[model samples]
Each structure stands twice: as C-alpha cells, then as structure tokens.
Target: MRSSTIRRALAAASTVSMLALSVSACSEDTANDSTVDFGYIGDYNGVSLLAIAKKLGLWKEVGLTAKVKAFNDGPIQVQALRAGNLDFGYIGPGAMWLPASGKAKVVAVNTLAYADRVIAQPGITSMKDLKGKKVGVPEGTSGDMALNLALEKAGMTAKDVQKVPMAPATIVSAFSSGRIDGAGIWYPLIDTIKAKVPDLEEVASTRETDSSFPTAFVAGNKVKPELTSKVIKVLQKANDWRARHPREAITESARMLELDESKVKADAANVETLPTADLVAKTKDGTVDKWLNVLGDFFVRNGQLESAPDPSSYYTGDLYTKAYAK
Candidate 1:
C-alpha cells in the first residue's frame, strides 16, 4: 500500500482497538446506559466551579458518573469531545465557533462575561509596545484567541508581535527569564505571575470588551440529546450551590484546586454563574445566537472561518429548558 494509505489503515485499526477495549470494560448495565465524561482546560481558577461541582457530588446527584478530565486548553478539550473521548466540556466563544460548525453542539452557555485578561511586564504599556517583543500564549487556546482579539482591537495582529507558543504552566519561567514581554492567560496563573513579577500590568480584561463571549458546556453531536438535560441539571445544581453557599463553594474549590482561598474567591467573583433556566431563556430569545453570530462574523471578516455557519443550529436550548423546568 502507499505510505498514506498504510498510515490511514493503522489509524483506523488503532481506533477500532480502542473502541473494543472501551466496550469490553463496560458492565452490562453501563453498556446500555450513558456516562458523561467532562473535559476542561486546566488552571485552578478557570475550572474552580467544576472543582466545586465534583467535590460536592453534583454530577452524581444529577444521575451522571461524571468523569472530569483536564486538558491543556479549550481547543484540545473541544477536540477530545468531538472524538467521543469526552461527553462534554467548557469552550470559549472562539473555539466553540469552529466545532459548533462541525458536529459539536453547545448545550448551555457557561459564562457570558469575559473572565480573562492580558497581562504584560510592567514597562509594556500597550499592544504597540509589544511589537518585536516575544509574547507567550497557550497556542490554539481561548487565551491565545483573546490575545489576538486584543491585538486586533489595538489595530494590530499576531504578525505585529513576536509569538511564543507555550503551555500556561511554563509562562512564568518564560516571563521571569525576560524571554517574553507578556503572557495572555486566565486567573490563578494571572495571580501567580503577578506575585512573581510584582509590577506586571493588565493591558486588557474580558470585562472591558464589548462582546459577550460565551464559554459553554458542550456535548458531542452524535450523543443522545437527552443526556444534555442531565448535564444541565448538574450545572444548575452547582450554580444554585454557589449562590446559597458561596463561602463553602469557594473553600471547597480552593482545596480541590490547591490555590489560596483569596485567589479562589477572586476567581469565583469574576465568574457569572448562570442557572440552566436563565441560559435556556436567553438562548431561546436569541441572546446567545446574537453573540455567536457576531463572533462568527468577526472570525469570517478576519478570515477565521471559510464561511459562517448558522448560529441557531450551533446551540439547542431544549436541554436547558427541560432540565431547569424540573
């Protein structure tokens, strides 16, 4: 066989073997019933709410044996969900646009407000100052996309600056060595980097942006849509817990994420946790549709997508409505 053909055959064989192994490990009961495997981009503050959900057994209470896994970033997490390795995960608006166009359906908007920021060395005041300066970003992540958006808002692009693609964990070392002028990342790392550099300045925050960026709970398109209701229920329970017991939620999340309580509290405050009912109403009323269309258009105008897909099909408010109605 041709080399390309041989490689394709090997990949197919590997996939089959993995599927067979997964099937073999399933009990008769579990073989028929569905299980949801949730994925998220790693970083204590980014997934602090998820940590609280898991710690409080919210998923179990909602009839899901939720297997939450950590990924490097949103792009990777979405890819895993697309491949059937994960049932659901959180994804930023940018990453969600691409997959939602394909076969991934967003079930609920996790957060609407921007909860991220672009932090740079003290002396770097603006995107213009970042020109010719090395910047570290978790490539293909929401953070990287956010950085691109910041640059665009400042009338620049990635080509206007030196780009260094690194994982979030390694950004601190890169910053300390003076190898990077800035790092676009989320909290906890933002907190850590600030402590290490003391004089680091935030150039932009999601809070200041004009867009309502939607980070969502997504599931594979092929999965039974009914399971989405279970996922929404779990999320609703978690959100309700947050409102009723903010301190306990913060404490449990901090312990689970191994971060200081104050940082966790700060991160929690930044998140706009929505109940499934509100999300369903908002989505049905075209709130999320409007945002997704705007974001899609932004990507297309900037040449991100070949053509924009219909935002309506990208999300279904049905699951949220059903889950929250109960």
Candidate 2:
C-alpha cells in the first residue's frame, strides 16, 4: 500500500473518492421491484464489501437487485436513510450513531477490526504527548471519533490540542510539511503518509479499543421486517465470494474506489470479514451495547448530541442470527 495515492486524479484532480455514480442502470422500473436501494461510504476500504458484492452480481442471484449509491462520509448516508431513502446502508459509527438514535437499526457489523488509525511522529510515544499539538482530522466524522476515543483513553479531550479539520490527503500533506503534528485517517491515505514519512507510526487504532466500532449495515424505514434476512444474505454471499476470490475482490474494489490496485490489495489485507452470527453473539454479550454507550457518551461529552439514544430501542443483533437459520 506504500506510495499508493491515486495518481490518475479525480474529475477535479481531487484525491478524495469521487461521489458521482451511475444509478441510471438500476432505474425507476426496477425501484418498485425487489431492487434494494443501498448506500455505502465511498471507496473506503473497511466498508467496501458491499461494493464488491454489487460488482460480483451477488444481489441478483438471490432474487434481489441492488441500487448502489456512494457518499463521501457516513453523515450523508445517515441523512438519506433518515429521509426514507435506502433499505440498508454501510457506515461507520460516525453516521451510524445518528440513524441508531432515530429509526435505524444495525443488522450486521462487518470488519470488526479496522486500520483507520491515529498516527504520530516517533517522539510522541503516548496519547498525552499530543497535548497542545496540532492534530489533523476530518472533524465531525469517524476520523474525529477515533481521535477523540484515543484522547479519552488518555484522560484528554479535543480541547487538549488544536483540532484541524482537513481531508485525509490534506492532513497527510500537513503532517509531512510539519503543519500538523499528527493525523487521524484511514488507508490508502494513511499509506501515502507513511510512504512519505517513514518515521511516523501508528499510536492508536479502533481495533485495540475496548469496544469494536466495526463498520455496520443499518436498516431504515425502507426495510421491511421480512427483508432483513434477504439483505444480509447478499452480504454473506459477497463475503463468500471475496474469500474465494481475493484477487478479484481487491481488483474490483480498486476500480470502484479509483485507487491503485496494489494499494487496494494492501488495504484489503487490513480488513476483517466477520460472520453475521458472531456479530449477533457479540451483541448479546453487550459488546455492541458497550460500543454504543461509549459512542453516546462521547457525543454528549463533546456536545454533539443533546441526549444519548437508547441502545435497546435501536440496536439489535437478533436479525443476523435469524437470517441464517433454516
């Protein structure tokens, strides 16, 4: 994944993933049918499973069609879902928390572990050392959540340092140019930063956090109770194919994200594909509950939410276990 920035450049030479997608193919004619309108966080490696599924034709095999939409971040996905837009969505805790606070339900969590990380210079051995330093993050997004989570763990807060809201690419540049002391980001952007500054290294990761803040699929008003099983089956089918065809999976994902194949291949290795049943079991044991609690607390502590939503009312893993049962 080293030196893996998309050199091809986007429509405006932007390094961020392009937001436009061809939705005309899954047009109105199929909208009234079983074609599920799905949304995904654009080209992000951790949540790219659904993108791979769409490319592999996994939806149609089970008598379903998927209308895929791409968004730059989770907040956008949350907005569409809340307005009765999608049946299911792939998002991180950043946006997932909003829908969960409203009418959304998390049916499944994939990629229990993530490489979206907090990296700092070698001198900063601990999170506390970041105090008073300039830290780059895509503020009000999952990047900030990961960064805040790290800070909270170190008995610190966003106020402890200067928070710079910038794109991941910009953050990488800032860090390299000594404008920012550290950054909270994910691959392949993180890969680019590391490639340029070998001395910079990861100090915290969502994977090591007490709760697993996995990228999850949230169902909204468009999802009927009976359709939950079918929706997840498509994801499982995609996961099955991904395991069988790792090369094809990465190649297709690279095409979708418009990233370098080598970088996608490297990013793919850092992603975790978990079974739906395992997620259900984890939820039952209060793992997901704890994560939501921690997330809600973070929001309230940071004044992002007036009140934390109830976990029982919105979050459930029961749907996942029931989906696979004969």
lDDT scores of the candidates, listed in order: 0.64, 0.65
Deviation (Å) of 234 in candidate 2: 1.0
Quote the positional error of residue 275 for candidate 1 in Å.
3.3
lDDT by residue (3-110, candidate 1, tens digit) is 000001111101111111011122334543356677654333335457667766665565556555655456666677778788877666557655646758877777
Q: Which candidate leads the pack in lDDT?
A: 2
True-vs-predicted CA distance for residue 118, candidate 1, Å: 2.3
Give the C-alpha miss distance for residue 54 in model 2, angstroms. 3.4
lDDT per residue for candidate 2 within 1-326, as digits (tens), equals 00112211121113323232232333334444466677665443433666666676666655566666655455555667778776677666655557556757777666653656788876886778888988898665667777888887888888998888886556767887878887877655666677678888687877776565666777875577667777777676666666677788778777776666776677666566665565567777887777777778778876777788777767655666666564
lDDT of 1 at 84: 79
The residue pairs found clashing in candidate 2 are: none
Q: How accurate is candidate 1 locally (lDDT)?
A: 0.64
